[model samples]
Target: MIKHIVKDTFILQRLSSVATENDSDIVKDLIDTLEANKEICAGMAANMIGINKRIIAFQDNGKITVMLNPEIIRMSDAYKTKEGCLSLEGQRETTRYRSIKVKYQDTNMKVKIKTYKDFTAQVIQHEIDHCNGILI
Candidate 1:
């Protein structure tokens, strides 16, 4: 389980490495835990930014989405409407993005790349910025 740190105690450092052998198990466990938890919806919020993001794979078309502390290292010229975050009091601010390509490590410690477009990409970008200590 992740230790959800308080705002004052939150730190913005790179995440630690998970054991290679235990990655799948750990990610699965986390996915189950989060999915079972009624709060995963809100836990899906920026509150997870500083919190250790648990890796969870989406079952559709074998999409493995391990989003723990994922960051967007690059962005395109596209732009989208700002999304609201629970931690931010649900105020939309119009964050900018055209397209975004993100680099992240998955449960298997394998590097992964995902391309985002329009609003979806913006959400990812916003969440990534949150992981890097930018809030808005």
Candidate 2:
């Protein structure tokens, strides 16, 4: 089911806990919400839907990808950019990486490590920051 976007900074600022197999429902919700808002949004964190879990869904190529308990293990080629959130009023300046290697679990709860670059990497970094309770 698609959920309402959460705009409460207090709730968004809270650190998200690790996701388990039981939180599979949240993955579905996140993907659903991301698809619903795809016209204006490229990515979404679990916190964005009022559930503080380490889950994120984002546009990858022409499809939506979900990451559970995502952690950025390595990042390089940093640059400054401005970004706007669906949960925020306006754009904010922040640093983003051009490339990142992440460790995360898939929808089936299997661990996977992957490298991303350019816009995709930036989107992942933003969502991971949300999991860490850091807002731009």
Best by lDDT: 2
Q: Best-fitting candidate, measured by TM-score?
A: 2
* Candidate 2 TM-score, true structure as reference: 0.98
Report the error of model 2 at residue 52, Å. Answer: 0.9
Q: Model 2, residue 60: what's the lDDT?
A: 96
Please identify model 1 stretches exceeding 4 Å from their true place.
1-64, 78-80
lDDT of each: 0.50, 0.94
Write candidate 2's Cα lDDT for 1-136 as tens digits: 9999999999999999999999988888898899999999999999999998999999999899999999999999999999998999999999999999999999998999999999999999999999998999
Kindly give the stretch of ten consecutive residues in candidate 2 with the minimal lDDT sum.
24-33
Give the 10-residue window scoring lowest on summed lDDT in candidate 1.
55-64
lDDT of 2 at 86: 90
Could you give candidate 1's per-residue lDDT for residues 1-136 as a string of tens digits? 5334334324433333323535555565545533544342322322342334433233223233456546577876865465655344566766587788777666556678887666556656655655455566
Candidate 2 Cα errors over 4 Å, as ranges: none
